[model samples]
Target: MKKLLIILIACVLGSNIGFGQSKTKLKEVIVRPGGQKVVLGTKREKADYGHGGAPNNPKYQTAYFIPAKGASGLIDRVGIYIFQKHSFLEFLKPSNPVYLYLYKADAKDLPGELLVPEPLVIKPKKNTHWYWVDISEYSIALPNDGLFAAVSWPKATKEDNGPYVGMTNECDSCPFYLYHFPSEPRWLKVDERMKKSVEKGNKEKLNQNLMVRLEVSLKK
Candidate 1:
């Protein structure tokens, strides 16, 4: 009887081990009010394909989609907010897609918006000019490049308002740049008064207005 019990326990342990190893990797997504989804990728950047100049307006800020996943480098959300001076501008239209780039935290390239859902809104606010996005209906599996995000927008326009560049701090040492030129955005050189606000932290950060972006991930 003792030998039989030992054999049964060993069989149970082996079966559990095999089951755990064979289970498919499940992917999860987190959504922010602004519609940014951070997922875990395979490869991050894809072939370079773009044309146009950066936006002339100072309020027009660009965003680089940072994927949270690894290989395929798919993105479910693009946070529309960035650290500017001492304020935050949520997108007015939070569900509109825009062309964006994805990279590892170290700045390695990954895939673009290869397969993702569309955004939900696009309304503008007052002080700043970013649109807020709400992505509650779309979601994608995390890829191997580690989770990341991508930028998307309508076909290039001659207008002076929309963004023609996306910025990423994935490379901490270098300053983020616009897709059009090598020069950094002017906001990087915030005025002294605003610098003080950044030091003060979020308490000092205000939402003067809202800009907009797209939503492609969902949560329940």
Candidate 2:
């Protein structure tokens, strides 16, 4: 009986080891040389306007639709060019934080599902030409048809006016984009929103695609 017991114990241990070896392994993805990069949306050669304000305000939020083709990848980082405005200088300081969000687009091409449970917070680096936000650590996966990225600023404080990201009037090859307005109940496409605002002579409500880019690693 003692011998049989010893044999049973050895068999159980061997089975566990075999099971461990048979477990599936995840494929490894490496950041490509020069970093797999994609620039969506449009930015003017000279940005004539800025977007952002308090959280409750009708702030300008930008999103880029990852095309159905070649959308499988790991997002490493993203960056947007911030324009310098004398009127917003205090709000554009390094101390101010910008928030980033990855959302799944809905049927109407509006921001739908929130991809990350917690929003990623980015603080601008000192004197950097571009406000680069690094999120490689999160290992965000780009869904084939539903992925989009957005950025927004928190409410302004008495000490700061709140920073606005720079955007040009140029809209060539720009991806489907939308913006939220303080008065509007939903996100509207830039073209549609601009047209409606123009009809009402509300030119101040107009905006354009932000200067944003994404660095991603294609799945092997």
Best by lDDT: 2
Off by over 4 Å in 2: 1-46, 54-71, 85-94, 125-128, 157-159, 172-185, 193-205
Candidate 2 lDDT by residue in tens digits, 118-179: 77776654432456667778887876773677776665343453455555445534444545
Query: lDDT per prediction?
Result: 0.29, 0.52
lDDT of 2: 0.52
Where's the lowest-lDDT run of ten residues in candidate 2? 16-25
TM-score per prediction, in order, is 0.31, 0.62
